[model samples]
Target: MSNIKGKLIALGGGDDDVLLKLIRSEICDIHSHIEVIATATTEPVESGNAYKEAFEELGCSNVRFMHIDEANAADTTDHIERISKAGVIFFTGGDQVRLASFLNSTKLLEIMRRRFREEEIIISGTSAGAAIMSDCMIYDGYGHYSLIKGEMKTTHGCAFIKNVFIDTHFAERGRFGRLAHAVAHDPEYIGIGLSEETGIIISEGNQVEVFGPGVVTVIDASNTRFSNTREVEENEPIAVEHLIMHLLVKDYRYYLKERLFQPLTQTMPKEEAGNVALPEK
Candidate 1:
């Protein structure tokens, strides 16, 4: 398991063509299989079909849907076997809480984690699916209300990355305050706000690079000097000091290990020179 490495793509909701193509090229070939899990979505059948069509259109011939609508379904031997053989496992958007509730601590999730650690597979998701990739997930919270104490709710996630707190449809939904609240609660964690149609690719070493047609906002509160989270009453606005933020467009790279941002021009590898094109501006 220590020698095996994989990739994780957390996407904000909407338009995943480029990201999917990249995943296919990196992890799949003509013979590789891709599993689309739509347990997080209310209409799993429809969502599954949609992804199946999309993947097929991308020339992925071995794409199948794994329907796990309940906790009991997650433990089925068939589901576990499908996951074990998949080159890619993709989760669809619905409700983060729903996904976590059934999948958490389940045998299926354990198998997925094991595959992620010991095999060369890609684990990707959008919207609520993206939120479940973190150790602490934002289950409930809205725009401005999230600025107040006790307005946000969080729960344990799939634990793909513990130090990152992910929020999808960030700017479009005005979710900065919610993500900020989570960062204020635990400054040691890095808060990632992904806008619609955007995503971040996190390598095994925690090297992250932004992609897509929108921006990715990063909020770092590790060096904060003050916060009134503890003193503020419920529903009261929080006051924090010295929180750092960075906006990243396509090609910008970030390292979670060192908490640093590297511009695309400086970090782009020579081998990938022409291959890395800037997202349409």
Candidate 2:
């Protein structure tokens, strides 16, 4: 597979919705002109066009909307052709479970893999769309600070990015609980908690750059010192320690390659400052 050097962003819900400025910024950096394609995974036939209007506001003449639900209406080759040829693909936020069920093992998923592999194609998702980027996705809600049992479910993400668990509307929704739950269950992943209107661009070098108006929380437990809550039951507060979370703000960059953080302009802090010390795990 080719190196996926193209810019890829996972945005929280409330992105520059109608203007799509953030989305356009990523696309225009690589391509002179962008061909925007909108896919609605959650909407019914009646309301699917809602996202399409968002794309139209960017004033791209070549914007096309493809209903993945309509993939069954056409042959597999047609589906592949439509997706593979696009310059940028945008997945609208809604029910991520609905999105996964419709796209998994389908021609659309394959083409998405191919498009990323070939280079110059940007893939972006927001909210439920953002949640679906992880290999293990949170499909449904279970009250607060919870997930349905056996609901520690796994699904096919676009795999544009890997080993990273994503949750959107992070700060606003108090989603720290959701992301912490995911990391606690599986410590191997680095949880990406995106606040509303905020996004993080994961470059090919694995660098995660924060964008938009809010914060992108990075929960790094890969080298956690301790956790003794294995026997603990669900919804119960488990103890943990040394869980590192860095808030990446706009114009700041976190490079995954060097494992270093840098501010966009000088006079800003080069080293990340915040470290969450949880109860012993």
Number of the top-ranking candidate, with TM-score as the measure? 1
- Model 2 lDDT, residue 187, Cα: 71
Q: How many backbone clashes does candidate 1 have?
A: 0
Question: TM-score for model 1?
Answer: 0.90
Candidate 2 per-residue C-alpha lDDT over 1-281 given as tens digits, one digit per residue, 9 for 90 to 100: 11665667778887446226767665564333333323434344433455555555665455655655654432267656777677777777777777767777766776676667667677777787778775676554443535433334445565666767788887877767667656765676677888888888776626677877788887776556666446666545666677767888988877543344678674424444333233333
Candidate 2 lowest-lDDT run of ten:
272-281
What is candidate 1's lDDT per residue for 106-159, written digit by digit as tens? Answer: 888888887777776788999988899978888777889989899888889998
lDDT for model 1, please: 0.82
Q: CA shift at 192, candidate 1, in angstroms?
A: 0.5
- TM-scores of all predicted structures: 0.90, 0.80
User: Candidate 1 has which clashing residue pairs, if any?
Assistant: none
